[model samples]
Target chain A: MKTASPFLELEAAPARATVWFDGEPLDLPQGANLAAALLAAGVAVFRHTPASGAPRGPFCLMGACFDCLVEIDGVVRQACMLEVEDGLRVTRPHEAEDSGAPV
Target chain B: MRQCDVIVVGAGPAGMAAAATAADAGLQVALLDEQPRAGGQIYRDVDRVAALRGGILGKDYTEGRALTAAIRRDGIEHLDGAVVWAIEDGFCVSYTRAGQAAQVSAPKVILATGALERPMPLPGWTLPGVMTAGAGQILLKQSGLLARRAVLVGTGPLLYLIAAQMVRAGTPPVALVETQTRADLMRANRHLGGALRGWPYLAKGLAMLAELMRARVPRYTGATTIAIAGDGRAEAVTFRSGGKPRTVACDTVFLHHGVVPNTQAARSVGVPHRWDAAQHCFNPVVDAWGGTAVAGVFLAGDGAGIGGAKVAETAGRIAALKVAEELGRLSADERDRRAAPLNRLRSRQTAIRPFLDAAYPPFAEALAPADATLVCRCEEVTAGEIRGYAKLGCIGPNQTKAFGRAGMGPCQGRYCGLTVTALLAEATGQTPDQTGYYRIRPPLKPVTLGELAAMDDGARDAAE
Candidate 1:
């Protein structure tokens, strides 16, 4: 009826990780995506609209939706589709963040 | 353990057909079915729904009522709402009844657990109104009601049948988005020659299409729904129409890639499966008589192959013949005569399989869900996490479970296993069948710690 999850205890990945995200020193499993690692790290709200200021998060997790767009390295790509790297720099643009009080 | 002569699981078309055929042969059959009613998802219990909604039986399920009605007669013990979790040597079945651990022992076992529709992961597949094609059909068949202006996304006859039903139920879809090309449909139709003998089936399906056409349901072939643009519920779907992207405003987007056999129980028992290229899913190989590689265990219906209700009915009959022969109840000549119609049906099924398989070949390219797409929706595991688990020498789902915590949650891999398997297949270049479904075991659902401690003898308290 049930079984234990293998990834439940896994914290890190193989050594010498090289890929990078927004522009931060990220500690994540090798080959994991920015969205998944971020989700694991509790960064549920990934991006926001500039005009409406509505909160946007990774919805489909698949690249089909494009709801998880973030500034990775340099280009605006779907965070749900890309793998992770050490020392990745990930940043939320002012337009991509809700500017109201810290809710 | 309380013992019985035979225990047939899944009260659907195959199980009912199997139990009835065996009973007709004078074997005391104990039929264990998970649904509150006998009909599996195909006959999905719409007697009341049909009584309410009207005209949703759609021929295939209408034919199933006769077999279920046969269960009401004596000698066939129908245990509805009884979910069988595991089977052991001597065919000890572990299941739950009234939230209590229970078991049923039988000499011979027949697994007729049927197939389920494959939910293609798109942007909004998780949305409220977005559902599998079968789910939509169940809604209409049972309630004779539906949301207005649907966009049915899928391939094969399921979409055709369901869309036509939707029109009848008052939805009247704007257009049907088919993933198979017209050329593929032509190739699918070529097998129609061999299948021409099943004229009634052909006519019935054609009639559904006619309803859709008469209602002006524009069918766009080779289209895939890539995006669903709406808040909360589905308001519109953005799909690639014939390779060119377009958007259709429809409240409901009924989706179904195709059907895949529910294989968790089989996987748990180590039942080996072959890559059924025609079904694009893993299926256990069984002899014409329904005997699997495992002794005393027989496979039947869509669980063995993704054939329709007719094939399922015949498969059930063949299992009964084999069981009767094993019990020395069937004379050789009688058995041969009884098996004739099924053999003919198999030949016809073989003829059309190639076209159906080619047309609906599991949406391979769409397997890789975006990072946000929840692989294990219950545990919030994403496709990216699954990929991470894949690189760590985890070749199978069981091993991946150790590294990702994805499938080990409530909903028990129902929402995520297919999506994960497809992702694994894409990464490893293995077919979808090779990526095994979740392994089922006793306590098919979570139980309290006290319940485990209270367990005693596994054999039934008393035989039905």
Candidate 2:
């Protein structure tokens, strides 16, 4: 899962605190968009489609496309729309399919 | 509860300019935007990120700093991160900010909600690594991020601009898969005289193309049969170039064709709209100053039509001046005198729009995607399913949505509305105007029940 980032960490930019995703703490840049922070940390798989079970990620990061929906603090929101905050907990929202047997 | 002389719907180029102008004329203005900052998609975070990101976002984008500064200096009440859910009669706007409910009312309302990328639902577009070129730019603009290896797809100036931006950011896309045919460019040559008036835009596009060429990115033009294929994430894009099937291996596929006016807010308020035959979308019918048939309601910027940022800025100013005149803050003659230069500049700015519209139309085949291709990514409805609904006498997008639930998603039909409209038109053999758009309801974006219950009914009642 090694993805080289093209974003340069400019010295003038403010330093951000680390956030946790799936129990792993990631040191992401302060004030960067949450989606970019996750991607910068090599976590691109944001969520899976409810119907098709296909992996889906950010598209039209300006809130037009809802593909970047991720669960944060018990709610799902577009990751690109929310800014990265210190100590924020984020997790990929999963919708389980019916196994065809009665629960 | 807050009452203002005018409430501007968006804080983008149009809304910012509108608020500034009205406030300058002694009107109390309330500007609302869903984003944490002003500057709509075109200038998202321009006040902060543009200067920090340096030359990657381009000069036009950074120019939003001026608008942001002007609005702040004008002492206008700016409500950032406000999700306006409902607009009642008499211009009462119900919105939520930071999980708190608030209502703002005014006699006049200006809708500058802006434009969105035209939908292109191709096979495998729902894959993880696939996205729009505008989305890719958002990553760069908002977070300074880029894909490792991307293959840009489709056509239009935004595609080239994003490619150039990527090159500047030191991560040029692996290739460009263009759907526009050589014949299309030849067809656009007819309007070259008008297009030449805006030489700077054309020259900027050319410079971007040259940059892509210099970067040695393989550009496949006139591509037919463009498709993205992957197991779980995007692996490669297959497109036909020069009548030969070609596949480019890439991790990301960014798609774009053109933009269309976002008329949801206007359409929701029952504002009149007409289909623009050239742009192939609904244009809100407005006067010279963005005033709609609905008295107090105005439509400005790309929400009225796709005239780019400069045109949106001018349209916003004109709309504000009109508001000032209506409020008796300025005489009609004075308003017109102030607006004349902006009107002239807007005309010159938009002179080349017809040419661009004709040149980079949305992919016709995308209107009728393969039977299996997903039209509604949220609901997993396919084009074939929508066509089936159309064949069954579903005359409009709303009816199709009722039958199959294509647009009943979290996005509220932002991505699929135009595609559904076009698909229904192609299937039903009716014009897009007859096909119509989705019927947007109140609580437009999802709002919490608590936020709704907490609203001050007194404010809304007073305005009504």
Candidate 3:
């Protein structure tokens, strides 16, 4: 059986969208959900914990579960639920590192 | 890992009721839910409720508010917006919230993840802008993105409930298509009367019907959807009732039969399930208490059945009582005493269940929409691919995966799993429940290599 791909590999295409995560450049779909485009671009776990210091990732891709939640345009929201608007700047929530707010 | 005496998944009715009762008994309790807010689908957003004071919330809604307020107390730790990936041993769980994946462990686990829409495959169901009724409702509720004109299809109280909500939300429904025949509703009344006499739900249903008539929301019963018409998303849906074909011009269509339990957390921890002959879904058979075959892991709420919010609250109390007894927080006598109210509610609610099971079993025999009917919109697989897989002797989802890459997608097999499994089972002459989901792994979501390596080593050490 083909190993169930937990994530898809990003192919380098000329016509690509540049996604910056924590000041890093990544290729993304021109119009993908903030999370799906990120995942397709080889981005992984999108959040972290303040208490136990564990990593977090999306579970329910739909907006139902906030597991895929991230900070897009200065708002905490479900990354999987948000459609990727062109030039949308999304970052890990303030809870990840720095000030240390656990989601 | 952070430890608690009890960790209840889904802070809806079941989780809320369970946490409140258990915490009252002095056991450390943590209530977890996926919504950015605490209330599950039934209660929806509390702020939404708080905003519209004179809305659909009857006396029943008040209890939800009370439960949420109760969850706010010190003893009960509420984590809203946490999506559970799987359940590990001793009720250890992995979840993601705030774009981060984290782990929590508890000695006692109560899963109340609640219900999700069960796809009833039909022609044109996969058309763009064509969505499940529940999906449409979520889109409308969460983001206020709704079709100004639409059609509602399928049966049970939900079709009515969602229609009424849409009407209230100022997005009126154009057509209501119910698969259940008028005769079925009449027959259901025999049980409905008994159930209604005890609860205010009947009145609520009547109000919805009145609203439908007043709004002149064109309603049709015994309607069968033949196909959908559109280039990309749904432009209109074709249906027939009483041998007359009618095409409703719709920008959006909400298709639904009802909901089924989300068994990922339950099945992952090895909870045994049986083909629920009535609901036509797989439900873990449990004792009167929420105790499952798996120790310390109890199943409750709509995850068990389509029991409404009240029954879920009662079931939660029953499960919490069971948990309390095991945790030495309650005496055996107290546990027995707590079971009485729940038993009464169960007896009242279950009177209508068997009728429901028979009337609405996802109409499995009629699942194939049409060969031209799209099944996997994302992958562009159709009824043709299903038949091709069948001819290839792909007996199960795993085997089908070995052949055609059916379930490998962004959805993690949610949208296509049921249809693929059902089609395979039908072709192979096997029971649908036997065709369970593909093996699930975590991130559950994907993260960047940077996200993975950027983990703080000290914090990671603390978790382990």
Candidate 4:
């Protein structure tokens, strides 16, 4: 279920790929920028800060700022740096450790 | 370990041009870039996106195709999707690709790492939907994504350019809240002669503004006390414009003051840097031909200073020529003959820098945010905490890492270093140079332990 996203995709992708964000599967444009695809899919909050647990998203999409960090395949990396590869599993960094605890 | 005569880090205009030029001089050139394709942030993903979105992003961006194409020639080894983490002594460059570590050694290294958007910290800037205007442009260029009701804040030519791009994309911004006052433009007029010499840039900026005007994008100039307002995400922006408080409700806020040199790669390798007061950031000290104090290490493009793409490309060509001369591939006479025109081009390209710097100085509040505002997003360190550290005798950014973990995050002080120095300088009554910046070390980008252990040290030693 796609939420109402403020971001709009200017062009439609010829192919689609499914990637699991947290636990929800998002069918996104294949080969598109991962952070952008997720944003277009309405996944606003990319990760929560480790210190204050405050919600954070992609601030600088060019790899300088690490605010768009997400845990992928157990290694946390910048989501803005990655591409939308099919079957990729991404989770909020430290989400497993938080275990649904309030941020 | 792989060996090359020259290793060019970054695939931006400078790196691509350097690699191409060095290769043309018969030197083995290896180009490494963080992105999956050639084209650094300015021409990011140009190989794929230029054909589709060239009409929207403009000709200046599409022009990057020539440099990107140049890197694909013979004698140039291009490694895309490579994250450079360390540049050890003896010109050894270590990077990771595809979750695997690798090392390459070169007699000469050219750092064309380019610039990053200067952090514009404001109240509620840490909200989820608040992002840099550069980030928004990246979304547009890389994936054709556009935020429906985004408000652009802060001051710079880039703000106007992005607003115009959005207008062209048929989803014009709700408004542009600029921070530059009329006084700033008047102050910048002193450099009008140089700006006129560089008329093309000024003309392009005016054209963008005119496009925005035609699209009816509401613009608020001389905006001050700017702040994002929201709960979990950015819902609106509040600022003082025309001596009146104005609130613009929007789903997203894109903030940009200006860009600064990304000096981590250069500084990490023990390169000497000085605080550029005009640009308000630290820049690696380099000669006209991009020769640094560190031997065998050449710095070019915006990584050395905040020259834009054209200047960077010219600098890249000039540095490559100098490198060829240093390696005895080209004689001094030939190098000078080749570099003289590029030097002239570079000077012409940089003529507008002073005007732009004066016209779009970084937001004053962002330089020293309100006490409650967070300066360090990674550690949740507030400006008040940084000030407290200064009161407690913390004289520099290096010390703040120990006191409040301000620069200890994964970013390694890229975002907060300037702000931290500014806060300490204000509190301690010292210049930014006296206040000092973070002591940058290796592993510039985050590298996993497993990836580190998987390195082929035996091959490296054998090559050594």
Ranking by DockQ: 4, 2, 3, 1
Clashes found in each candidate (C-alpha, N, C closer than 3 A): 31, 0, 18, 0
- Model 2 misplaced stretches (Cα beyond 4 Å): A1-14, A94-103, B453-464
Q: How well is each residue in B364-421 modelled by candidate 2, as lDDT tens digits?
A: 7686788889989898899999989988889998898789889998888888988898
Runs in model 1 with CA error above 4 Å? A1-103, B46-54, B242-244, B331-333, B368-372, B429-438, B447-464
lDDT for residue B161 in candidate 3, whole number 0-100:
73
Q: What is the RMSD, in Å, between candidate 4 and the native fold over all Cα?
A: 2.1
The model with the greatest TM-score is 4
- The per-residue C-alpha lDDT of model 3 at residue B362 equals 61
Q: Tens digit of lDDT per residue, candidate 3, span B183-230?
A: 776766666556554455566667888988887888877877556676
lDDT for B362 in candidate 4 is 95
Among these predicted structures, which one has the highest lDDT?
4
Please provide, for model 4 over A1-103, each residue's C-alpha lDDT reduced to its tens digit, 9 standing for 90 to 100.
2358889887899999999988889889888888888889999898888787789988999998899999887778899989999999888887855355454
Candidates sorted on TM-score, descending:
4, 2, 3, 1
Question: Of the pair 1 and 3, which is ahead by lDDT?
Answer: 3
Kindly list the per-residue Cα lDDT of model 4 for residues B281-395, writing each as its tens digit.
Answer: 9889898889999999999898989989998898899999999999999999999999988988988999999999999999999999999999888888999999999889999
lDDT of 3 at A50: 33
Using DockQ, give the best candidate's number.
4
Instruction: For candidate 3, report its TM-score.
Output: 0.79
Q: Give the least accurate 10-residue stretch of model 4 chain B, judged by summed lDDT.
A: B455-464
